[model samples]
Target: MNRKQIAVVTGAHSGLGKEFVKLLTEDGTISEIWAIARNKEKLDQLISEFGNRVRVFSLDLSDRTSFSVIEKLFLEERIHITYLINNAGFAKFCSYDDITVDESLNMIDLNVSAVVALGLICIPYMKKGSHIINIASQASFFPLPYQNIYSSTKAFVSNYTRALNVELKNKGITAIAVCPGWMKTGLFDRGTIGADRATNNFSGMVTPDVVAAKALSDAKKGKDISIYGLPVKLTWLFSKVTPPKLMMRIWLMQQGIKP
Candidate 1:
């Protein structure tokens, strides 16, 4: 039996996740797109917009049980996932002292844990030419001051995706970490609260569509990490040469905060 080609995208209700869904819908090879998100209303909206081509799963990835639910569905349906986009994550722009313990752990649960879980659950269903796109951030490059937890989580994503790509090459599976600079997304709306001073300067911000397009292009080329925009690429290069301490200081300076 020919398996139905599907694309699974978490955080598909909005922002980069939605953009990924949009692009995947355009791909002729994909038979269906699985849109996973927390908002039932928004997911329903996506169904209305994209019609039957898109299927929405209203599940919060941060909750560990959601992984089991996804795995069960995959087993029952026996579907082939062509593109697995792990894009459900959030950030808080505050000092360690300001953020509650629950918030810090939630960030890790969604950003780091969800990425790993989804990859494991979906990999068995993926065949050759399958692409796994993890939405990492340019913040992964350095030790950010106020955005400490978020940056660290993204750093883990970047490293994990690269290493996973190397391991999955024999299986003809590609994992690409998209490290885009500040993008026009809902992340800022939640992250910028309570830290207005530190979040004021958003340099080299671009739209989610731009990053989504570049990520797909890079994935086609089988690149390990897909970085959008020249400014972000340049920053990635700079991060390699600069010391960690210095990079932290520079990030603080850029945000108009004292080191």
Candidate 2:
């Protein structure tokens, strides 16, 4: 019997990551999945639930050393990684004056650097038809007030994915950026920015399952950029027409923050 196709999903412990795992596993096309995350207990529980089809990897994406383990697994198993989903990210809300340099840098590390590094690292293991999905955000469409670092990181992902998609097209490898708005995940509840009174109003957003479904569907279709939901799409359109400074001022005012 032919071996089933393999997929790797980062941030698989919760939110859209967990939903992606469930959706892909039930699709009947994928036979094996590597659910990567830092939480071992949650990973183990998912493994138990999904049985032999799902393998849990205790991975900290910020740790560069973990790439070697992924490389080794790919080679030894002779697994063709048909899909790679970069879904791990964090957010924080702080005024430009209140946010420290270190905090901003860390967000860059996880949100942009890690995503780029993983895509590069996994390239060798990915076959011609493989797909790489980078999770960006609607914030990429415009500058987000008080959540500057997080918004910038997602914007980087959006632009990077699109550029790489064009470059890799010749090689038959597809890259897509999945941009979703206000996902109703613990990401906000557990986020530094989401806890703030200024940002908490944006809570109770769209569900993870909906985002995952739309993203996966778009990935399969080889879309260069998938912006989910009507509100997010409109936001993207608005960004194109609105001047940056004016938009920034408006957004800041909406958040009850002075620019």
For model 1 the TM-score comes to 0.98
> What are the runs in model 2 whose C-alpha is more than 4 Å off?
1-4, 96-101, 193-198
In candidate 2, what are the lDDT values of residues 79-124, reduced to their tens digit?
A: 6678899998888766665667876777788898889988987887
> Model 1, range 1-259, lDDT digits (tens) per residue?
8888999999999999988888888899999999999999999988887778999889999999998899888888858989999999999888887878998999999999999999999999998899999989999999888888999999999999999999999999999999999899999898877764455678788999999999999998999999888999999999999999998877777778876
lDDT of 1: 0.91
Segments of candidate 1 deviating more than 4 angstroms: none
- TM-score of every candidate: 0.98, 0.92
* Per-candidate count of clashing residue pairs (backbone under 3 Å): 0, 1
Best candidate according to TM-score: 1
- Alpha carbon lDDT at 74, candidate 2: 73
